[model samples]
Target: MKQLIFSLSFCLLAMSSLFAQGIQFESGSWADVKAKAKAQNKPIFVDAYAVWCGPCKWMSANSFTDASVGELYNSGFISYKFDMEKGEGPAFAQQQSIRAYPTLLFFSPDGELLKKAEGARDAEGLISLAKPYLKANNNANQEQTTTDNNWESLNAKAWEYYETKSNRSDLSKALKWANTSIEMNRNWYNLDTKAHLLAKLDRNKEALELAVDAILAAQDAGELAEAEETMELLRKLRNN
Candidate 1:
């Protein structure tokens, strides 16, 4: 009987250690955690809990501490835990439309809500809930990178033709490349390139409109140099 009890205790200790490691939740304000997520370009995982909730405590002691949960959450997400009833938590919960204890919220890097759930999840369930959002965000980031690369190449091609400007045909080709790039991304650089190409094609009105758009996009992106350049181009277009 004594040996059996000792064996049971050892087994329990081993199991505890097996699942001891878990998600490393960030200790920061909601704004700070959101900023970190944006900086890392990773999705945010918010554990909205209350001290009085049984399931919240269960998850804090079990599911959140599981090794697999830690591995996935730590690697793929900017994790945070907030008490729904304390500090900034109440305001955040109100803003997020959190209505229940142990609310699981996933947000994009830009702070858009991606997914939400109420109640506690087991380790496997939590992992399952999070995997799709992470995968979707990763895919979106990859696609945007690829699209940006393609737009850069097209923009470069357009610039080469614009620099040459040997004939009307060359100008037309430059406009085509610029149009393609703008279609891929309406970023300030591409929009400015398109505006200049339109100006070369003697479409002054369209060029002015595109230049304005470029300025606005630049302002949104905080690209002061691009905005300045677009302003100069806008003046030139207006003069024409």
Candidate 2:
């Protein structure tokens, strides 16, 4: 009974070790990793390490397996581990100019190198190094969201005036709002709105030009559905 219990305990221990949570490193080419990062809107964290490096092995066995490290890296980054002395790893290391044993590289979603660090770090040290970049990225995303919201609100207000068309004065006010919206973001919807406002105000030539721009912008954004109205407007403007 005692031997059986010990065997069971050993099996449990082995299972736990096998399933231990850590930085979930992806298996793929560098291009695949970058593509995934772009799709997920997450940064890339590359562990450029060598097989014979003591520090690199120590980090892999200790710090990377820490739960906190796993949570942060797995969530915020598309992590990859490359053996710098083997296979395509040598070429990649050369390209990235990695000369050290355990170089940490942080890249933006678009694959721009954002940060680089050399040497191995404990879990706390690694977390501390990564936190600021993630925080900054989060803050930037929030600011962009706010800007988009503000521009959308402005566009809606402008469109309201366009729909009402109570007077020439209202059209003029709508034009101002539309211009501001376009300045904030020269996207198809706002461009279309501005073009319509210009047409209402009898600025046919400017309106036609803006309509064309809107159509092209819509196409570029893969928002061709929104371009149909703009196309119709362009046809009318050409006839006039």
- Report the lDDT tens digits of candidate 1 across residue range 35-95: 9987997889999999999999999999999898987888889999999898998999998
Cα error, candidate 2, residue 90 (Å): 1.8
lDDT of 2 at 134: 81
lDDT of 2 by residue, 1-240 (tens): 999999999998865554367788999788999999879878789999988899999999999998788878877889999888887898988888998889999877657676789999999998998887687557545544554446788788778889987555456556656787888888999999999998987789999999999999999999988688899999999999
What are the lDDT figures for the candidates, one per model? 0.82, 0.83
Q: How close is candidate 1 to the true structure, as a TM-score?
A: 0.57
Deviation from native of the Cα of residue 118 in model 2, angstroms:
0.6
Q: What is the lDDT of residue 173 in candidate 2?
A: 52
Single out the weakest 10-residue window by summed lDDT for candidate 2: 140-149
Q: Which runs of model 2 end up more than 4 angstroms from their true locations?
A: 1-20, 149-240
